[model samples]
Target: WLLFLGITLFQIPRIASQFKEENWHRISETIPVSEGTMLLTLDTQAEDPDFNEVSLKIEGTADSLVTLEKEFFSRGKTKAESLENAKVLGYQVSVLDSLVSFPPGFDYSAMDVFRDQKVNLILKVPYEKPFLMDRSLLDILRNTIYRNGYKSRDVREKNIWAFNEAGLVCLTCGSTTDETENQDPNEDQTEEEQINREKLDSLSRAKFRQRLDSIE
Candidate 1:
């Protein structure tokens, strides 16, 4: 009994050290984190094994998404205390509700290099104006959010959504709850095509349409 206790105590420190080391490595690969931004981790034990008991939540503006996505790519691969050292696990990208499946050979270093491309694409979306995404895209994004364990109401507040590797709902947009009360769902339907053509800046509209087409 004494030997077992001693061994368990020694293992505790080792395990804690390992967890911290892995976390630091994950953070290093995540670039362009806005100055003064905070990174938070939450662990909640659950009886179910399919879902992660712990989750990482980030709060930032749309522009910060680039950094967030890169961190996600990096951290998702690194061995976490909970993930059993699996190189790739389930993940969701909320911006487009896109399921970023980790192929057998996904490399975090390679993904870091492409971060700029994703950031550039995000820049194309004007934050100053209320941009309207197609319903289909919104649905996809919303679904991703749900898979991430966030509710639709919460995601509507942030106007973003997320998904996981198994295409599960993980998080939802957290926009103003009152939005649904003020706007009619059908209001945008009639104007979608016309607004796409007339209101948006020409180049921006083209870019948006191009992205929409690619997703389809």
Candidate 2:
């Protein structure tokens, strides 16, 4: 009985840690920054039902190299299977040259099953380096407020932003003194807002198609 109690106590910490890790799968990757402006976009990817929910946060890091942080929750019948789910999700983020593009959601076909799959992306920019988020991304950049004391939806997308000694700052916001911490990623979204964003995306797609047809 004594040995059993000792063993159980020893295993408790490991069990707790495993439980925590299982709930939150984290992935970090280093993106090579180009000499000038870097562009971020996910708008080009067509939205699919399998992977429809995604949230992204833009942050600044002093690390020099551009860092992309990803977190998600996935489940399976066993720990090994769950890890495999995470591995499949990790493969979906593709960075090409100065343009870093990630899907609004992951591809479910590769994931095997959907276990409350949610992907949250954080794009970390280097200090004083310029970056722009494609206007189409206004929907996915959720629960995040900008450094100029504004939220993603409120800021004008055409201008550039960058990280500096004070954290994230707008290169063209005109006023540089405003700085605040980013909001929590867990904020809830309203059903009305979701519907509106879907409409906007559909309209953007239509406009893009029209432009292509006119060119041809």
- Which candidate comes out best when scored by TM-score? 2
lDDT by residue for model 2 over 1-216, one digit each (tens)?
999999999999865544343455788888875666688777465564345467888776778788878886666556765666666764355566787776666655676655556677888876566777777677677644543345654355655566554344444444323443332222244567445544543443454346547779
Give stretches of model 2 more than 4 Å off.
Answer: 1-22, 49-51, 77-81, 90-96, 146-148, 175-216
| Candidate 2 residue 11 C-alpha distance from true site, Å | 32
- Give the best candidate by lDDT: 2
Alpha-carbon TM-score of each model against the true structure? 0.26, 0.60
lDDT, model 1, position 140: 19
Per-residue lDDT tens digits of candidate 1, residues 97-196? 2222111112223332221111101111112222222232332132233333334444332343221112222121212354332211233334664344
Q: What does the lDDT come to for candidate 1?
A: 0.29
Q: How far off is residue 90 in model 1, in Å?
A: 8.9
